[model samples]
Target: MPIFIDIGAAYPNDNRVTLVVWGEHYDDFAEMINAVDHGNAWLSVTSYLEVYEGSLQMNSDNGCDYTWWTGVG
Candidate 1:
């Protein structure tokens, strides 16, 4: 199964983005980067994380719920 995330959820209902991820990237995330728009918001495997952008993570905790940056120079 893919992951699901809500972006800009606090904004107007129509402004919200529901992201789904099966592998590397999320649906709109690619659009923001000028890539093809598909699937939901994606997550880098914990192994790919260089920095965790969120306060909580860990597979036991809702399966890696949080944000992260990978391969930062």
Candidate 2:
């Protein structure tokens, strides 16, 4: 199984493209976000999307409803 973390700005903003990272474990996936925040700057730090095993886990969207879905075009 794979876990993913997404970070970026939402709609109607001069945000950067969403950054996606993959890890096999949840802890690794979770910790990576902090590392990223420290190492770089996000266009929007107010929202984040996490997915585990191809399922949406947590989404704290404060912008234009940034959500992560699996294979739905």
Candidate 3:
């Protein structure tokens, strides 16, 4: 089954923006990077849909995970 990674942005004023991103569909990572680089903070991932072999999988037991890195060195 294919996995998905949903991403989002949030604000300090309790504003939360969400986005749904599919796994293996990161052909536009550059755009996402640019968006975050422009001062947009990620809020949280709402949910994801599982897929497999170019098809949606119903009984997939996979889940999403996240990792963060500080840009400052």
Q: Return model 3's CA RMSD, one decimal.
A: 11.8
Worst 10 residues of 2 by lDDT: 62-71
Q: Rate the local accuracy (lDDT) of all candidates.
A: 0.35, 0.38, 0.36
Ranking of models by lDDT: 2, 3, 1
Alpha carbon lDDT of residue 9, candidate 1? Answer: 46
Span of 10 residues, lowest total lDDT, candidate 1: 48-57
**lDDT of model number 1:** 0.35
Stretches of model 2 off by over 4 angstroms after superposition: 1-12, 19-28, 41-73
Least accurate stretch of 10 residues (summed lDDT) in model 3? 9-18
Candidate 2 lDDT, tens digit per residue, 18-67?
A: 43433433453354455544544322333354443453334333222232
Q: Which is the winner by TM-score between candidate 1 and candidate 2?
A: 1
- In the range 36-55, model 1's lDDT, one tens digit per residue, is 22324333333222212432
lDDT of 3 by residue, 14-72 (tens): 22223334445444343554454555345233235444444432221334333333342
Clashing residue pairs in candidate 2 are: none
In model 1, where do residues sit more than 4 Å from their true spots?
Answer: 10-12, 23-73
The TM-score that candidate 2 achieves is 0.23
lDDT of 3 at 29: 41
lDDT of 3 at 49: 47
